[model samples]
Target: MASRVTALLLLGVVCFGFAAAEIVVDCCLRTTDKRLPLQILDSYIIQDAGKGCDISATAFITKVGKKLCVSHHSKLAWVKNYINILDKKKGGHQ
Candidate 1:
């Protein structure tokens, strides 16, 4: 049992190390320094930004819902946080 536990611990450490080794690139949106929905591509916000980064419906859902389109949890909170901030700033202030 002790040996088994040790093996499991080592495996856990290895898995975590591999996870750490992965690289992340900024995509459409930003929260802090992360590209929102690192896994999913959502609507481009550039258009509304009056540029070219318009958020597509697919990307919007993926980013907002954490819908792991590509299985990444990248922009998980940015979309929600952005919406929350917008709500408060726009008319839903609480």
Candidate 2:
């Protein structure tokens, strides 16, 4: 019984550590629930911050003067395409 309790305690500690290490990305907006969907980000300037809430991140400044962070591994097609568009905008081609 004592050994089982010890194992459970170790497991709890490990779980807590993993939870604490989780990356927290923020969508800095005036209202908590209000958000402009990623699809409409085509015209927005998405800049690479080099560092973010996670190791890989892209950021953009909102019209409300908030800096929003996006994950580099985002699975959204629009998000990926928008980044490519931003790259092309930087130069003549991507």
Candidate 3:
């Protein structure tokens, strides 16, 4: 009975460790340089490199509920403009 209790405790710790690791994993491993139309985008989330991610990125959610990760350093100015548009939509100046 003692051994069975120890096995269950070990299993619980292993499961909790896996769950914790999943929480910190980066969302975007690769980013796209392609520019998307603002009309299709529903909103955007900024993925900070400081928050366990390798690179800073913008994950845009489309109207149909799809996520598109884009590089923050894309040469085109449209990405920045789109972010501004999204901010304005949320009534935020930043």
Best by lDDT: 3
Pitting candidate 1 against candidate 2, the one with the higher TM-score is: 2
* Model 2 whole-model lDDT (C-alpha atoms): 0.49
Clashing pairs in 2: none
Kindly list the per-residue Cα lDDT of model 3 for residues 1-94, writing each as its tens digit: 9999999999999999988873656478788888888889888877877687777888888889888889873544788888878888883221
Q: Which ten residues in a row have the lowest lDDT in candidate 3?
A: 85-94
Off by over 4 Å in 3: 1-22, 73-76, 91-94
User: Which structure is stronger by TM-score: 2 or 3?
Assistant: 3
Worst 10 residues of 1 by lDDT: 42-51
Local distance difference test values of all predictions, in order: 0.42, 0.49, 0.78
lDDT of 2 by residue, 1-94 (tens): 9999999999999999988774644522221223346433433433333323224444544435555555442644555665666557653121
The model with the greater lDDT, 1 or 2, is 2
For each candidate in turn, give its C-alpha RMSD to the true structure in angstroms. 13.2, 10.2, 3.8
Q: After superposition, how far is residue 9 of candidate 1 from its true place, in Å?
A: 0.1
Best by TM-score: 3
Cα deviation of 64, candidate 2, in Å:
7.3
Ranking by lDDT: 3, 2, 1
